[model samples]
Structures are given as structure tokens and as C-alpha cells.
Target: MVLIFLFSGIQAYAVDPEVPDSEEAISAGQSIFNANCKTCHRLDQKLIGPALRGVTDRRELAWIKQFITNSQVLVQGGDADAVALFKEFNNTVMPAHDFLSDGDLTNLLSYIEFGDKVDPAAAAAAAGAEGGEAASSGGGIPNEYLTIILVVLVIVLVLVLVVLGLIVSVLTKYMNKNDDLDEDDKAFINQKTDYKGIFKSDGMIIIVTAIVLAFVVKTAINGLYTVGVQQGYAPSQPIAYSHELHAGQYEIPCQYCHTGVEIGKSANIPSANICMNCHMHIQNVEGKDGISPEIAKIYDAVDNNKPIEWVRVHNLPDLAYFNHSQHVVVGGVECQTCHGPVEEMEVVSQYSALTMGWCIDCHRNTEIDTQGNEYYDKLVQLHSESSNDALKVKDIGGLECAKCHY
Candidate 1:
């Protein structure tokens, strides 16, 4: 009888009464997750944060609430679990979400519990409705209004100019008829006032030709210089790898797959082994009927002991030299600074021109981060002592020809 009672209690606890397993709650939770948590947390995979599918099951509800509300406070107070988590994640601090209401938190918890059970079609429909609602709520002046205003202004300016020309013509005629000017003098004045004839004169033509020739020469030179520059050159890769899904949605660090980024010359292409780390278990995508063909390619390569040939997107000239570690690690430059919004890209493409002028502009404008860098400490101190201006990349031989070229 005692054993039977204990089993009943276990069953009751499994189905909690406080957390409502409703579609509305799940949808609300999903929205919250996408907006806030999706950047660092994945449902079934470890990203910057731990997999949060069964987080509630692992920890008590009260403890979870406290940790989520203010993890730093808990860590500072010497809470064993919080400290352990902080240490485990290489001391990466979780941002506190104290602003989330109790109702919102409950909904988030409910979604975590029953999110896997929710039908994909239904979820998509709900998401579409929410997106439409958001679009409707976004209030701004339409492009049509601005275009109409510009057209009207141009028309008004043309009308004003025509009226001014007519006024000038009448004044000239009236002055010639009423004033004590001779017929020869009047004829000479009319000849001078012939705007069309003046425009068609040899002097005017020569000046215009010179200006045109200068513009054409400049344009041709610019075109020649940009012959090999492949800005926005997005080539189709062997696999349809979505950087948006991996980096943007899942918030995987750029350095995670590009292992050599912080230590080597090249930001090496991710090998099949790196893909296998996650794809070993997540064989199929969520909405797909079978294993994703793109993911399968990786598996096939690994099994057959072959390398996946990923096409290079961003390429520099053979003469130029670039080190990934120098910029990424030492200089503390963000990957997106050169690559653009890589997380938003469905198919990764060259976003920047990557021209000599572009690199020079970056070096001229970018300020070096001197804090915690022992190499730059002395240089920064000398500069600070010498002048009030902050030290930029150009100040430390960034623009030198040898810095980029061998």
C-alpha cells in the first residue's frame, strides 16, 4: 500500500498543475525564447549556454527562478550550483533577466516542457500571424509619400525657373524699346542674350569636352583597378551550410568551427570532423522528412575518409598577406567587422570590397584596444604621455606596405 501511494505521488509530480500546457503558453514561450534566449541557448544542443530542453527537470523551480533572475548575485553569494556552472562555462557570465514577469517565466517553462510535442505546421502558422502583426505595428512614412514629395518639389522648381526666364526676357525687350538705346546696340544686346547660341559656342564645347574627358578617364581607371575585386561574390558551396541557422539562431561562436582563427594565418575552412561533433546525434533537421541531404554529405565524407571541398568565398590577391590571428586575437577585431552580418546570411557571400582603399580606411579609423594587452601597454603609455589623442591602428605602422604585402 505504501509503495502504491509513492508511485501515485510520482505520477502527480510528473504532471504539474501550476504550469499550463496550453498552445497559447507554448507560443508565447517560443516568442520569448527566440527574442532573448535563442542567441546563446539551443533546445537540444550545447551552444554558448547549456541545452535547456530538460533544464527544469534537472533543477528545482525556485532555484531556476533565482538563477535566471540574477546569476551573478548567486555566484557572488557562493551558491554551489551557480559557481559550478560559471566555472564549467569558462567563467562566461550569464546575463540576468530580472525584467521577465512571473507569467512570462511560467510560459517559458511550459514551452520548454512541451515544445517538442507542438506540431511544426501549427507553430509556423502562429509565427506567421505574429510576424504579420509585428509588421502592421511598425509605423513609418511610406516610400511612395517621399517619392511624391520629391517629384512635386522638382516640378515646382522647374515652374519657378521658367517664370524667371520669361520675366528676364520681358525686361530685356522692354528696356530695349523704351530706353535711349540705338537699333544696333539693341541687336547686339539680343545677340549676347541668345543662351542657346552661347551654349553651342566653341569655348563652351571645349570646356564641356574637357570635363567629360576627365570624368571618363577617372571612371575607366576605377573600373580597371576593380577588375579582380570580388565584392559580393557568393559562390554555391558543395553543401548548403546556413550560417544563419548555426551562428545567428544557435549563437555558435565564429572561433568554434574556424579553429585556427585565433592562432594561425588562415581562418581555415571547417573540416567534416567539426560538423560530426553536432551532426552525430542531430542527423535530421526539425521539419524535414528525412536526414538533410546537406548534413548527409558530411557523414558520407567522414565514413569514406574523404574531405568536403568547400568553395572559398573571400579571397585576396596572391601578393597580399593576411593573418587571421593578428586581427582576430591580438587586435581584437570582430569577424563581422570584415565579413559583415554573417549570422543573417543564408548563403555566405563577400560583403566588403576588400580593396586596398578599404583596408586603409579601416586601419585609419580603428582604435587599438590597449587594455590587458602587454604588447601594446608601453606603446599606449608613450602615446598617452606624448599626446591627448587616442592611439589608432595607423599610429603603429598598420598602413606600412610591408604590413599587408610581402
Candidate 2:
């Protein structure tokens, strides 16, 4: 019966694309999860947080939103469910999520509801519904809007310029005609012809002002856009490595490849010795006998009988600094969080935008892991004073420039 209702709900939403239960809410909820919840919570399994499966059945939407928006508060308020869950999890408060708006919270609730009652046919139909729309579009500023705006702006600018030029020409001719007058008269005429003064008084003044304003805005936007992009950076390697296979299918733990992340300053590229540990035994792969061609690259660098060439990914610029220890060890950020799902990738790619905006967004929204990290003991103390017990990432200073830049 529950499954039947779920299927009916999906079909009902589908027949009415403008309806609330349609994919928009589901996709928005998915985005919210990807951005905020996936790190600690899984839908079906016990991770850092309780499995979210069947959450809708167990909790009301209002309670779920409040819990997600501020779990610590519910725990402190002695809400039996929140308090019991908190204690069950060792009194570790789930991080507060004050950033999600009411609409976003609703979307998440809808998704949770859908997940609980999902039917396979409905799921398939939902997936197939948007295929045509996605494939036909390119990802960038939409050309249609860009073209329309640019054309309108150009036309307005040209009209303004033409009017200004006409006025200037008239003034210039009048001034020249008065050239034969007395010197004082000529000086008066020249003053009347002053193009700069005319520009200040005419409609041209507004046009020039608008142009300057537009230029300033464009420059400021571009400056902000480049703040955290590392387009072509390549760094020296501890060992030569090939991403082709490891990422391709051997599907080694990203933590395995970048092991140092669990304990040190970087998701440090594995040292040559680490490579030897694996290469020494599983020297061959993909049915190619002997040290696979890629593994041989590692052996070459180690100066062992065989060698390997490892290239660095996620290289921070010289001006910027990164600490794997701080993020991985202290913040409890997963290695794959910033580096991306490297195990499933063919070649490593810079997955996170690593932009200041991107970093700050995560920092602002992510709940800090406060339970065991002594660094957050003081913050946890203050939060306890409030009836609400949520601990925000900001409360722990995740957005401080020194946290990343220094």
C-alpha cells in the first residue's frame, strides 16, 4: 500500500510538471544532500550520523526540518527523540544547518518522503523525463539571454554616442564661425565649445557615467572569479604515478593513493616506498603480465628494478597554502571531499572549484565535528547554554582567511 501510494505520488507529480512534488523539489533536495549531508550521513547505513532511511515515517516534516536546520537545539530542548538520538550517538550534537531556507528544507523533506515510498517504475519515469532537455543544452551563460542583453546594451550605447557626437559637431561649428571675432569674443566662444563641459551637461554625461559603471562592475566580477582557480598548475611528485588504472577500475581507496591525508599535512602522494609495497606483489594488472606498464612508471622513479612516474593533482598555488591535516584530521573532511571521487575517475581531475566562494559556502553550511575534537570544546560549551544545541561550522571559525591562506 505504501509502495502504491509512492508510485501514485510520482505519477501525480509527473502529469503536473508545475506541481510541488515534481523533480525540482527532488533535485533541489539532492543538491542540498550533496552539498551538506553526504559527508556524514548516508541514507541506508550507519555512518558518522544515523542512517536516514525511513526518516519520513519516523519524524514529522516540521520536526525533520527543525532537526536538520538545528539539531543541537532540539537536543538541548530535551525533545525526547532529539535527546535520545544525541545520547545514543555519544552526546555528539549533529552540526546545525541554519543556512537552509524554508524552501530548501521543504525540498529535503519532500526528497526524504519520496525515498521512503519510492516505486521503481516511478523512479525510472522521473529519470527519463528530463533527458531530452539536458542533452540539448550546453553548460555556460545561456547564449539567448547573453545575445539579447548585449544587443540591447549596444543599441542604447550607440544611440547615446550619436546624439552626443551631433551636439559636439554643432558646438564645434559655432565656435569656428566665431573665430574671426575679437580675441575676447573668441575666448568666450571657445569656452562655450568646451567639449568636456558640454559632456558634463548633456545626455552624454549619463551615457558616460553608465559606461564607466558597467566597466567597473565587469572588472570587479572578473577579479572575484579568479580568486581561487588553479587552471594549469602541475607540481613535483614524490613518485611517478599513473591515474589510468588506479582510478579506472582497480578502484584503490582514494585514501590508499593519497594515504598521508588521514594523518598528515597533505593527501600526500604516496612515497616510492608505498608504491613498492603494492607493486612488489600485484606487479601486473589488466591481463598484461609483469609490472603493468603504468606500475613500471613508479618503479622507474624509485630506482628499483622497475620505475613509476607520479604527477601531482590538486596542487595549491605558491601564494596559497593547504593543510591536509587540518581538514582531514581536525575538520573530519573526507579525502574524497576535495579531491573528488578519484577511485572511480580515469585520470584525476580538480573536482572542487576550490574557489573562495566554494570554500566559504561549505564552511558556512557544514556542521563542525565537535564531539571528540578538543579544539571545539569551548564552542560546545557556549552552544550548550542555548536551549538549541546545534554547532555551526562558522562557530568554529571555518571561514577565517588564515585557516586556508596562511
Candidate 3:
């Protein structure tokens, strides 16, 4: 009885006050935090402020809520913890989150405490997904397979030449040994091939002309296919922006910068004010003495009321119409599916060919994700009845000429 009581006391002392652990509460909290707190705070990492995992345990719930509503008020009121926290962070003032309700705070705390608790199964699944993504990023034959094919072709060609040479040597020997053959016939067969005459022969000329014409026609066809395809077309922008650092290292969401990607026809280029939202506080990369030169351009543009002229890397011809929202929001296509591994790119480039043929190929191959979509329910039912294959994008008008063309 004594041991059980002691253990119970220890467990109670170790655990923080329970926050709501329901999925609904945590999900609601996630929305509020991503919109407001995500820029400055993290649950486990010290970003612009302290890690927030143990806030409910360390401070009174009311005090935490009041400080979140307005930290400056608490600091000015000489609340010891708030003043100390502000001083600890070099007097950085946390913005007032007066808009969040009491329920919102509870939900937010629930997410901070119990959400994303690192399930081993989920981690394994995530690793598998990353491997799949890497494998799918490459198209067509792998490099090693292509190398092996070239090697086999060269070997076959060499064998054919060796066999032909052996046949010629045997024929020459037979002609030299024969007693019945005339001297003139033997001389014609045994003599060195007339290299000069062969070059000038009508047969040689015809073969040469045929090869040249074939090459020229093939070149013309390939050139026509690639007329406006600008794959790997990375252009210099006005500001030296590093997508690798921002998107890859910092892990900022794509929609955060390309704001309209999910909502509209265009993935809108973020304005200078959006840059200021972070740069106003960040100023420079960690360990730098002053503002970064590239970031300075953003400040200059915002201050001068002039727009930064960013170079467009991807261009679609006027004949084609692409709706970003249709693919991104409705179809649930990943940005990387078309843009390649943009998070790894230091400078943005046209990764995909973005040609009509490329689009058609994608439509032919990509299966329509019809789960939970009422619009696709009837179409999927009909498709299943007719065909055993999963419904592809092409089945529902993805390849219709008018889909892209007027």
C-alpha cells in the first residue's frame, strides 16, 4: 500500500496538467497556430520565442492566456516571469493574439502538448514515402541500364565486323589455292579493295545520300518536337533568392510564398510585404552582423513602393490554358509532381518540359484520385463497370483538346 501510494504521487508530480487529447480539438488548434503562432514559435524548438510544450505545467492557465493576449501589458505590469522572459529574449515583444478565444487557447495547448508524438509506424511510413518519391522522380531508362545497352550494341557490332573479316580471309585463301581459276579472276578477288573507286561508286554515293537524308529528317522532327520546350531553363532573377535555404532547410510551406497556388489560376508571386513579415524581424541569417544583401533589395522595393521584377522561369504559350486551382486544390496534385524537387533548387527552373505531349503523357498515366469526391463518384462507378483499370485523368476529359485550348 505504501509503495503504490508513493508511485502514484511520483507519477502525478511528473505529468503536466492534461490538455484535451481529442483529434478535433488538436486539429482546430493546428489551424490557429499555423496562421498566427507558427512564424515565431514552435512546440519543441526555440524560434523567435521559447518552446511551448510545457506552458500549461509551468504557469497558471489564466496567466498564460493573459500574456498571449498582450505580453507588453504583463511586462509593463512587472509580472516577474513575463518581464524575465522578455529580457531573456533580448526584449523581443511577442505580438498580441487578442483574437484567439479561451477555447482556442485550450485547443492550441492541446496540440502543442499531445500532437505529433513521434509514432514509430508513422515514421517508417514517412521514410517509405520519401524513398518512393526519389524513385519516381527519375523518368525512362536508368543510367546503368542505358550504359549496359550501349555496351551490348558495341560488342554486337564488333562481333559482326570480326566475322566479316574472317569470311573475306577464308575466301582469299581459297582463291589463291584453286587450280581451275584463271589468274585474272584470282587477281580481282585477291587484290586490295579499291578504296578510291569505292568512295566514288554509285552504290556508295546512294548509301551516303540515304544516311544524310535520314539524319537530316530525324533532326528536323526532333527540333519541331522541342520548338518551345524549355526544360531546365533557369533564369537570373533581380534578387538572389535561395529556394534551397527557405523551402528546403527552413521547411516553409509552398502555399506560404506562392499564395494563390491552391486558390486561383496563378501561383501569385509573393509581394515585398510578405518578405517584410519575416525579414523585419529576421534581418539576416543567423551569425551575420547586418541585413543580407538580397533581403536588402526587398526592403528597398517595399520602401520605394516599386515592385521587384522577378524573372519568370516557366512559360506556357498563349494557346494553352492551365488552372493551378484545378490541379492543386481539386485534383490534389503536389507542386513537385510538375515542378520537380523545387525545395532542393537554389534557383527556380522549368523542370518539366511543359509541352502538349508531356501533358498528354501525364494524363494517360496518372490515375484520378476519386476518393471522397462526389463529382467523381458517378464517373468512377461507370469507369469500373466498363474497365478493370483504375480511372486515369484521360478518362474524364483531361486530354480533351478544349481542356487546354480555346
TM-score of each: 0.44, 0.38, 0.46
Model 2, 187-281: lDDT tens digits are 66556446776767868878898999999999898677555435333333333344656655566666765777767776665566777787657
| Most lDDT-accurate candidate | 3
> Which stretches of model 1 miss by more than 4 angstroms?
1-229
Candidate 1 has an lDDT of 0.80
Candidate that would win on TM-score: 3
lDDT of each: 0.80, 0.66, 0.82
Question: Judged by lDDT relative to the true structure, which candidate is superior, 2 or 3?
Answer: 3
lDDT of 1 by residue, 92-137 (tens): 6778899999888888887776665534577887876554443331
Off by over 4 Å in 3: 1-229
Measured over all alpha carbons after superposition, the RMSD of each candidate to the real structure, in angstroms, is 22.1, 25.8, 23.4
C-alpha lDDT of residue 99 in model 2: 90
Scored by lDDT, model 3 comes in at 0.82
- Residue pairs in candidate 1 whose N, alpha carbon or C atoms collide under 3 angstroms: none
> What shift in Å separates residue 335 of candidate 3 from its native position after superposition?
0.5
lDDT digits (tens) for residues 141-196 of candidate 3? 54455567889999999999999999999988987898899989887888897789
